[model samples]
Each structure stands twice: as structure tokens, then as C-alpha cells.
Target: MPSSSATATVTTNVFEAGKYTTVLQKVESRTTCCPANTSPPPPVPPPKPLLIVMPCEAGEFPLLVFLHGYLLYNSFYSQLLQHIASHGFIVIAPQLYLVAGQDSSDENKSVTATTNWLSEGLHHLLPPHVKPNLSKLGLAGHSRGGKTAFASALEKAATTLKFSALIGVDPVDGMDKGKQTTPPVLTYVPHSFDLDMAVMVIGSGLGELKKNPLFPPCAPNGVNHKDFFKECKGPASYFVVKDYGHLDMLDDDTEGIRGKSYILSVQEWEVQGADEEIYRRSCGCIYESILGR
Candidate 1:
């Protein structure tokens, strides 16, 4: 098991020599410090498709859908999506929970419905300034959402959505039943899916969930990223951020875990220092794959 105290020493330059923050720069007046607010959210008229973030720029930009982890709201990833938008991409995040109840199988359908909405209904719903390129699309998620991303990519053949790239961040496969197989999360993992597009999995070296001092560590060793990387076919990239915890990818306090760093000497701010770097590297790959660069 990797020690929580282990510090990241080997830092390979993820960015190319000439390309430095040229694509993804933090937007001014809109820092990552912005809070997540689902109240007064974007209108989700009939058919009930959750709409999170849509860029104001009107053009044929690649559309990237971010799936929120179980029990987490879509607003939690606003900063991440906005960072991608800054780099010229159209991001759409949908709330995948059902007020009645939720199941692992629900995510696949949620993604499919959202994709259908994007291709058929988005133009009628959004303002005239918002334009999305449905042809070039990508799927990304965190935790259970990450598993959902994998599922969606694998099941893309059933939907009209054509995903060119897929990304998973610290994705976890959910619990399993004795024999029943109602929900897919019970046995789902990246390796279970057949992906044709370029793939990337971003994992945390410190799998412990120390954000809450009271809660025990829940992340399983190797199951999150290593297993996924090992299962990936064709060309793929895996990045493990040393000392970073499960929820460190979110904005400063979106999850209240950022205030309490898992490591004693390192503060939460320090653990999150590599988040932007990770986003840049992943988005760079997505952009390249979508545009065929």
C-alpha cells in the first residue's frame, strides 16, 4: 500500500515546452474559489434533463459531459468544467439522481437521455449564444460518476452520442450483491467496458479519504486507477497524483474536505495544487483526440 506520508518527488512535465497554459487559463473575476450553488439552477423543462454549465461563446466547440459521483451534486465540479470551457470546450453536466430513488443502472440511462437532449433539445432550450458540437464529444466523471463514464462510453453504441474520448478520475466500483444483478455498479469497472476512443484515468496516490477525520479510509488499493489502467486496451494514459485525496480535485471547499488535509504536514491547499495541472493534461489530451491534433 502507498503510504499517506509519501510525498511526490518525481514530477514529469505534463505540459509541452512551448504549450504552457495557452489553452486553459483560470478565468478572471471567476476564480476557482467560487462556491457551488444548485439553487435557481438552469431551467430543465419537460423530460427533466439536468443542465449545469453551458459556455456563452457560440461556435462548434467540443462538448464534454461531466458526471457527478453518487451523493454528490453537479455544481461541485463547476470550476473544473469552467476551466475546460476556458480552453474552448462546451461542457454539460447533468444531475443523475432521482428524488424517488437511484440505482447504478440509472446512470447509463441518465447519460443517454442527456445526450439525446443535447443533440435534439439543447438548441431549443439554451440561449442563442450557446452552441455545442455534438459530433465531437467526450465523457468524464469522478468516483461512481467515473464508473458511469465508463459505462456510458461502452454503451455508446445504443445511443446517438458519439464519444471521441473518455476520462475517469479516481473512479470507484460500487458494492456488490450476493447474486442479484439489478444495478450495474455491483460489477462495473473500466476493464469491464470496451472503449474505442483515447482514454485516461487520473488517480490519487493516497487512496485514503482523510477529508473527514472521523470516517475510515474507503478507497481500495489498486481497484480505483491501477486496475482501470491495467484493463485499458490500445493507447491510454494513467496519472497518479501523489498525496492527493479522493475529493481534492474539486474546488477549494466544495466538499469541505479541502480545509482538512489528509497529511499532517501538508495543508489541503497544497494537496490541491496539482489539480489544475491534472485538468490541463487531461483536457489537452481530450482536445487533441477530438480535433485529431
Candidate 2:
């Protein structure tokens, strides 16, 4: 477990969404020119209530499935997913509700099932000209969803669906033997997972500080990032962003209150200032390096 602080330096290259255009008009125009249009379009995927974001430019884009934090809505991460999609990757973020009685293990299974569904069925819904490369797949999540992402990867390794990379942004611990539990009372036990894929763990230096006092600290004792990073054995790297909170990596409208002030009402949010720049640069750097953009 080689953990280091902010002493390390990263060449900042911010990701600009305008660089790739996946607009509706252009996508429809390209669809007309697809060579494999002889066959009729397949039916839309079953109503599983999933959020899928795709790039406008036509090509065999890579596929990515994102898991959201426990209790947090999947659509909350739309901005982040859309930004990633603009870089030529198909992102699927599924909404999981623990409040509705779903556990971490249940959510983990949902992730795997969703990935399988995408691999086997999503192509039918896409434009004939726009084919997605299922082999080049990745799993990512925030908070507890990050833990679920890691768990899903382990589960996926057993089957035929293989993931090429895994990313966890300020992941929080909330599982016990594949079950879900909240903090202070439910302690998370780490497992020696054998993952054969590139791993990137992003942590925030101040994640636990800005958390609501009423609830337990988000990244208690660094279990969220450091613990997970240390356990990863194959092709793993860790990056810690100073002065950022757990919510900083999420989309602007994550909280139902809307706008940039919601985080402030409950706890101090670090979306502005250097934190935003670091977040964008780190996201771009990892995507480019992993997806070969």
C-alpha cells in the first residue's frame, strides 16, 4: 500500500466537451449513412429505468457503466457522465435506492446485470452506423457506489464479461460480506480481490471534514480511498486531491435542492476554486490514458 500525499505533481490538461460533437442533428445525419442499415431497427431496451449517455460522433465508442452512491440518484451524476461521453465513450449510470430497501449486495448484482444487458442488448437501440465496443469496458462509482463498482468487477471476472479498467472517486465504505450498512455501527471488511484491470482510485484530502456532523464522516479514517487503494494488487494507482470534499466529484445538481448552494446549506462544498480544476484535469487525464483517446 504505497500511499502518498499532494507532494506529487500532475500535468494539468483540462477536458473541453466542445472538442467532440455528439449533437442530435449530427448523430441523426450520420445514422442515415450507416452501411449496415438493411435490417430493421431493434426494439428499445426493456424498461429498467437506466440512464445512458452516448457520444454524438459516430464510431465504435468504448462502453462504461457507472454506479451512483447509496441513496443518491443516478441522474445526479449526469454532468460528469456527459463530460466523459463527449470524449467518445458510452456511459450507463443506473439508479440504485437503498432507501427503497436495496442493499449493497443487491446493488452490486444490479451493476453486473446492467452491464450484461448493455453488452447483449444496447446495440439494437443504437444507430446502425454507431457500434459500441463492448470489450473495452470500465466500471466507476462514487461513495458506496464506488465500493459496489469494485465488487461488481470482482463478480464480473468470474463470468465472460471483462472490464478493462475501474475508477473510484472518493469511495465510501458501506458493505459487510456483500451486505449494506451505514457508518459507526456497520464496519466494512476489506477483501483481497483479484482484479486483472487498470485501477485508479481518486481521494479527497478533506472529504471527512466537510461532512454533516449529524451523520458520520463520509470517509472515516480514510477507509474510502486509502484502504481500497492499498488492497488493489494489479495495475493500481492512487491520486489524492487536496482541499476537495466527497461531494465535489459529483454533478452540480446532486442534491435535490438544485444549484451550487445546496452543498453549502448542509456542509461546506468545494466545487469552485482549485478543486474544480483538479477534478476536471484528473478526469481527463485518466480517461485519455485508459481509453487511449
Q: Pick the candidate with the highest lDDT.
A: 2
Candidate 2, residues 200-275, lDDT tens digits: the string is 8888777766446555556665456877887787678788887777766666445554434445544544545644
RMSD of each: 9.7, 9.2
lDDT of 1 at 33: 25
lDDT of 1 by residue, 175-273 (tens): 322322234432334465567898888877665444445553434543466666777876677777766666665654454443333323232223544
lDDT for 201 (candidate 2): 85
> Candidate 1, 40: how far from true, in Å?
14
Clashing pairs in 2: 22-56
How far in Å is the alpha carbon of 120 misplaced in model 1?
Answer: 0.7
- The lowest-lDDT stretch of 10 consecutive residues in candidate 1 is 1-10
TM-score of each prediction? 0.68, 0.76
Clashing pairs for predicted structure model 1, backbone only:
none
Query: For candidate 1, what is the lDDT?
Result: 0.57
